[model samples]
Target: MRVGVLTGGGDCPGLNAVIRAVTKSLIGQGQCEVMGIEDGFQGLMEASPRVRELTWDQVSGILHRGGTILGTSNSANPLRDDATKALVSRNAKALGLDVLVVIGGDGTMSLAHGLADVGLHCVGVPKTIDNDIAHCERSFGFDTAVATVTDALHRIESTANSHHRVMIVETMGRHAGWIALEAGLAGGADIIVLPEIDYDIAAIALRCRERELRQRYTIICIGEGAKESGASLTVRERVEGSPDPVRLGGVAHVLRERLQPHLKSEVRATVLGHLQRGGDPTPFDRVLATRFGHRAAQLVLAREWGRMVTLQHGEIGSVALGDVANAQRTVPLDHELITTALDIGISLGR
Candidate 1:
């Protein structure tokens, strides 16, 4: 059997771990050849696709690596162009691929579903740092991203205390606020703002002022998608032809400006943009990626097409690609973490 592999969407930690596991598992079986697809689906559109035979030696010592060896792209959707879609199918046949193992977030999984509709066998492995894939308890890179954000928050807290200022740390989360919620609770942030709930500027400002009165600096954690009650603060305009064009950002800057009038201390915003996406994979992420990869390999051997590997209840499992594609799992309002944060007097800007 000849199997093709590619990574897509925003690059994340532990991607190399999944690739390593897939290549090593297939090679160990002694019955399959693994091909690496470069730059997501764009490789398939090339007249001479950019591909290289993957071997055990090539995958060794890559478990701790951050990015994907095969590379990735967020904007290459074959479905957008009929010629490109045909090229992808022809290229897969030219390479004699029996199946394609796609490791990516929601966007890539949706594309895999589309490819499968056109007679290409696809197996998906979830790989988002946001932990927002529907029906899955966790994804590979979420742990590493949370750890990075928590560490950054700790550092920001120290500086805010020393300077006697209100520091707002912005994190990435397009539709979900898992990163901000978990990191804020773990880092002991005084105010936590999430996209799931609209924030009240006056409440956040009052919290900052109260903390100032107690001779304490304030630390605020805000998700990039966080919005005011009636408006959204965006840093960039939507791209005309992009799939996800509504870029949610600049909320921290908006907060800093609005809260300044209510607080006597200095207010500043710090955007931790791509820092959460890069860096070495945490131990948990490495193990989880390996498990997901191995499960995908098993699915291939079992001829289970159009399925996505998922983590549920601390165990690796599989679900239908149709079920997961285009579905986002956002943070729930009545979650235990939210209650815990509220109990600890952490303002959620409500």
Candidate 2:
């Protein structure tokens, strides 16, 4: 059997690990051939698709690297245009690819599901720093991102203490607060804010004021998507024609400006933007990516087309692509972590 592999959506750590594992596992079997697809679905949309053979030698020594050896594009969606879809179909048939190991997040999976409907076999390996893919308890790249955010918070805390200031650190979480919530708890944040829960500026100001008398320093971890109660999300900008267009950002600054009037201490905001997305995969993420890759290979070998590899309740498994497509696993308001944060006296800005 011949297989194709591509990484789509935003680039993140552990992506190279997945590429290496998928290529090496299939090649080691000695019965399968693997090809690396360039620039995601955009490659296939080309009149002459960009592709190359993935020999065992090529995939070596990439496990420790960040990002994918196979290139990616977030804006390329063959499903949107019939002409592009036809071109992709023709290209796939011409290349004689039996299946594609698509590694990406929710938008990528949605594209994979649509491609499957047009007669291209696909197997998905969830990849996102947000850890918001439906049916998967955790996805690769999240651990590394969380570690980055936590480290940033640790570094920010020292300065915050020295200045006796209110430092607000913003993390990337377009729709979910997993990164902010987890990293805040790990880094001993005084207040943790999430997109899942509404936040009141007055409540946050009150908390900061209380800290001023005792702690004299306040550390807040806020998700990018977080906003004031009855307010719309803070959008950085919208990309026309992109699958996920709305870019959330600047909430930390918004929060800072709102709290500055009520708090005596100086308030500052730090946006940990793409810093969380680029880095070597953490040990946990490397292992998880390898596991997901192997599972994807198993599904492909078993002819389980249109399925996505998933990690549920500590076990690796597979779920239909349709189930994950267009769906997100947002953090629940009543989640155990939220309860833990509340019990520990961490203000959620509610």
- How high is each candidate's TM-score? 0.97, 0.98
Poorly placed runs, candidate 1 (over 4 Å)? 233-237
- What is the TM-score of candidate 2? 0.98
How close is each model in CA RMSD to the real structure? Answer: 1.2, 0.9
Clash pairs (backbone) in predicted model 2? none
Residue 301, candidate 1: Cα error in Å is 0.6
What lDDT would candidate 1 get against the real structure? Answer: 0.89
lDDT of 2 by residue, 1-350 (tens): 99999999999899988988888888775368999999888889888999999888898899999988888898888887788788899999999999999999999999999997678999999999999999999999999999999999999999999999999999997999999999999999999999999899989899999999998999999999998999889999988778888888999999988889998999999999999999899999999999998888888888999999999989999999999999999999889999999999999997
The pairs that clash in candidate 1 are none
Q: Rate the local accuracy (lDDT) of all candidates.
A: 0.89, 0.93
Evaluated with TM-score, which candidate comes out highest?
2
- Cα shift from native, residue 84, model 2 (Å): 1.0
